[model samples]
Target: MGCDGGTIPKRHELVKGPKKVEQVDKNAALIARWNYCAISQRPLRKPIVACELGRLYNKDVVIEYLLDTSPEKCIIETAAHIKNLKDVKELNLTDNPAWKGDKVNTKGDKYEDLQGAAFICPVVGLEMNGRQKFCYLRDCGCVFSERAMKEIKTEVCHKCGKPFKEDDVIILNGNKEEIADLQRKMEERKLKAKLLKKAKKSKAIESCVKSARTEANALSSSSSSTSTTGGKAEKPGKPVSGIAK
Candidate 1:
């Protein structure tokens, strides 16, 4: 039979084939991670903070999420790990001189460089764009490129001179393996803190019990001494009264 309007239908179109796999745009994903806040979905601003899992967020949004007791479900899921300001470190980012603000292409006629980053590594001067590996120090919140860290190894922060250990360095927007490692470290740290708190609480309870026992013993001893003294004193006075009768 002839097709409608004399249009020939291809065999591939008539017979359904296997569906093509949907792929995510790498550039868009990178922009989302590097340029936007994970919680509020707003553009990243100063006072940016990162969680233990290496998710970047604006400090104000994170604080708002923490303070809101009845937050939206998505906000809860996104920032549930952030209990307080202590859970996140405020990053000390260096401004990229070449990066014109996002307003540079407001007209939309000009070609915008997706790779332009607002911040860069203070140590190696590498842009904080998603192309390069970046890490922040938990101790001082100083950010540096992974290359600079490997090339110049030191116990103290390169930017702030604050001391930090190898464990204090947390990768920003890491891969699956790196994220899994970070999760494990986070769990271990939390477990250690919980155990320490429990130990301190037990110690305080033990001290209170010990003090209570000591006070009871002291009261009992004082009462026993007073009773013994009172029991021996009335015999002479009773004999004098009986002789007079």
Candidate 2:
């Protein structure tokens, strides 16, 4: 596939199912890659399969709608519902009646579900984290806790190397687990980039080898033709002064 203008033309809609059925409600456009547990913590990614509910939900609030209904339910969903962290102007939770007040007031930032999420109520809400935050918890690599923002003097994304709200900090538990996950994601990206570079270099070398072979063959053919032409150009001329015939 090639790009005609600045953007690549829509080649084919990568649907989740083998056959596109009107009965099935799915994002008929874009490709998705991951499952999102929460709209607030949607990984910076797109999922290929949009849960059946996602089809019924509005395009803007598909994730939020899903989150509100069943944070626990792994509804078939696509990643396209998520917006990038940088695009977020504000980070607010849609009150999940089922999971609400599960963990409203806790010392640590770790909570099991929306009930736990509700426990840590955000006092002053703001979107300081970049657009990537909306994609997914993994991609955003953010660990700003709403509690940390309230306790700390500054609101900055410790992971992203930028300033964000203490109350708005996307809180991952302050534990070795969070740190390790961040490190692992970073390492994964570095490895992917390295592999891609290596592949490109290998391809270039193969192309060079092919070109060299082509040029060699062309020269051999041209030389043979030139030799035959020279021989013909010099007429036999009666065997060139044969020896004392």
Over the stretch 1-245, how does candidate 2's per-residue lDDT look in tens digits?
55556665553643444665556323211111112332333332222112211111123445354345455755443334333322222322223234432244567665333212221223333321221122112223333334444454554443454654322222221235643554455456557878999999999999999999999999999999999988875545666676776
**Candidate 1 lDDT for residue 190:** 95
Per-candidate local distance difference test: 0.88, 0.39
The C-alpha RMSD of each candidate to the native structure, in angstroms, is 4.3, 23.4
Compared with the true structure, the alpha-carbon lDDT of candidate 1 equals: 0.88
10 residues in a row with least lDDT, candidate 1: 235-244
In candidate 1, what are the lDDT values of residues 1-245, reduced to their tens digit?
Answer: 55987888889879999899999998899999998899988989998999988899999998878778764545556577888899999998899989876554556765545569889988789999989999999878889999999999999988889999898999999999999999899999999999999999999999999999999999999999999998885655435555555
lDDT score, candidate 1, position 165: 86
Leading candidate by lDDT: 1
Candidate with best TM-score:
1
The deviation in Å at residue 31 for candidate 1 is 1.2
Q: How much does candidate 1 score in TM-score?
A: 0.83
